[model samples]
Target: MGSGFSVLLPVYDGDSPEFLERSFDSVTVDQTRPPSEVVIVQDGPVRPELTRMLARLVDRSDVPVVLVEIPVNGGLARALDLGLERCSHEIVARQDADDISVPERFAVQVPIVEGGADVVGSAIEEFVVEGDGGLVRVPPVGHEEIERYARFRSPFNHPSVVYRRSAVRAVGGYEELPLMEDYWLFARMIHAGAWAENVVEPLVLYRVGAGAYARRGGTRLLQSEVELQRRMWRAGMTSFWSFSRNVAVRGVYRVTPEPVRRRAYRAAVRRDAEREAHTDQHTDQPGTTDAGQD
Candidate 1:
């Protein structure tokens, strides 16, 4: 398989310039299998500091860096769709503007995509502070398991995925789905019969804190949850019963109090991490002990 790949990263005004620098360095300077090019999509007008940082990143980057600018602030889904068009390689790896990818992330995922998987993602380690203790969020490993898991929750970590550009474009790229854009696109890809898998190892350091949990709740997200469920049912990706169950369960989570939601989210992540650690002991899989949630 060709080692050439493009890293698609989207940044907005809300993103910290410091975090963006770390994220960019992780995918470019720190990767064991660095991307051939990096595409940074300016979702909207950013702070002056961010603009300067972007200029600096481009000036010092060893690989090609393509900057796609949007005059107005568009949401993540729209920004990603535009950025995907500028990607110059068949293979594309996603990187969040605030996350840190492990150096070997692409080294392991790229080969799986070349082996015929249309989409490949890995688990992530969610941390509030870099190098601090974090939980690893593990996803199901096999394609069949991933398909089954998608019926209830997201089957892949958005920022940790490496996929063929053709597969994503064939599925209609990313539609404007509020906060659930990644899940929506993945569901459509699955319905379109795209092969998918998730590496159990934690490959990215996902930053999570009070703000992250707070954003997960609220009326806007609840509305998006309902809309996403409706779209999934209309597309025949979920049965009527599944749709009803999801609307009831996920909807409640979206509207719950932020503190309650945060506790529940962390608890679930801890359980998954413990379960993965136990499984690793019995199997020969090479991975870390703690797991994270996404």
Candidate 2:
């Protein structure tokens, strides 16, 4: 197994320079096991502030930072596909420009990848501010549980994922799917028989605010949801009834009011107390499957 991994981060014009710096710091200076290199894709012409910030980050980084410039504004899928091509290592961990990874995130995930998992992800904590406590979104752990959960929802936290480049490329990297690109790629990987797992611990701090909730709803997202469901059905990842159910349920969720959507989203994640209770119930039990926690 290779000892080094690359960090793939794509930044666009709208991203805040401050957030980007923090993100870069988290994966580089702050990490216990820093990446061998960081491939930053400038999805388009960013603002002057972001441009300067990128220059400073590269200058300050101890590890190599590869900057790939896209002349025009392409979507996240395109940016990521292009970035993946530039990554120098077989193991590539994803990082979002606006999110912060825990210092030990890579330390905990890289070993699992070396141990034979094609893809590994972890729970994420969503926060409106930098220091405030946040709600944790925990996905199912273990390969079988991940495969079963993929039929209903995204099995991995895209920003928190560490995957093998060959596995992702063999399944044909990200395709254009608006808001559902990550889910689409993951679904394809899962269907292609990738070995996947998720850690119960939250490994990244996901930024969530009014904009995040607002983006979740809207006509465009509803349309994306419909198309995603159709693709999943055609791909044999979901049964006919499952596809229909997803369209009806997720489609409505997309078009609902932002406040209602926010409540629904929060309801799906666990609070600190709930997480502790769940850990107590599921951890260190004899002959018990990790699926019981989900």
Candidate 3:
């Protein structure tokens, strides 16, 4: 039998209502082949309502939910490290407190890990919720398409990823880099010769809300990529052409205006929608496996 998986959910205080409920529901696995354990690492103090909700979740748990509370606030990397240390399983999956994974996320990802890829992930579906209660779902992406973007930007959705515990440990786990810890982790993995693959399915429902990180322009994001490039070079993991291409890509993003960047994001979503429509038309005409998730 394959190794059972453990989930490390890192939650900071203040969570959106939709986000909290969706996150909890995503991991509220059914009786069959449930997670071996779930380590909820509370990063800091939470609102009374959040506390009450967590308490209720604990009481209602048919499977074990271990809550690891920190006395004070820790940053994202530290919180993840703490939860990772607590996991007893070989497969450690990541989830944010404010996002939801599709039901078959682990079911689909686990076999890919078992099949020998150190890092296995899937496409993500992002939902931007307006303050006035409206929500928009970004269109879907395929695994290969995501990989192409991964070289320049973060193609793999961090919270929607599952990785082999050994590989994570081998690379010194996650680092406390600014802004793009997830991207840095991927760079480290690729640098260390750790193979990665993604299911062509959309396995996560990611929540996007107004936050400081989002408000900040592309400066921080671009800086992180520069640091990633340095790290990759130090690790002797760079091809000359690929490195130059990455630099050129960052140069373009750096020069683009913020409004233009936002427009580009929206355009990417529209293109994804068109691609999906095309695929659907082709699939509907013949016997095809709808191997998609949302």
In the range 1-294, model 2's lDDT, one tens digit per residue, is 348999999999999999999999999999989999999999989889999999999998998999999999999999999999999999999999999999999999999999999999998988889889688888877787778778888888899999999999998899999988999999999899999988888999999866888998899989988999999999999999999999999988998898899998888765533754565576668876555345
Number of the candidate with higher TM-score, 2 or 3: 2
Model 1, 109-148: lDDT tens digits are 9999988999999999899989994878887767776887
In model 3, what is the error at residue 209, expressed in angstroms?
Answer: 2.3
Over 4 Å off, model 1 = 274-294
Kindly indicate the candidate among 2 and 3 with the higher lDDT.
2
Q: Please provide, for model 3 over 150-206, each residue's C-alpha lDDT reduced to its tens digit, 9 standing for 90 to 100.
A: 565665668778898889889988898776788878767766677777655667766
Off by over 4 Å in 2: 271-283, 290-294
- Candidate numbers, best TM-score first, in rank order: 2, 1, 3
lDDT-wise, the better of 1 and 3 is: 1
TM-score, cand. 1 vs. native: 0.93
Model 1: how far residue 144 lies from native, Å: 0.6
Estimate every model's Cα lDDT from 0 to 1. 0.90, 0.90, 0.70
TM-score of 3: 0.78
Which portions of model 3 show Cα errors greater than 4 Å?
30-33, 129-150, 210-218, 239-248, 251-256, 268-294
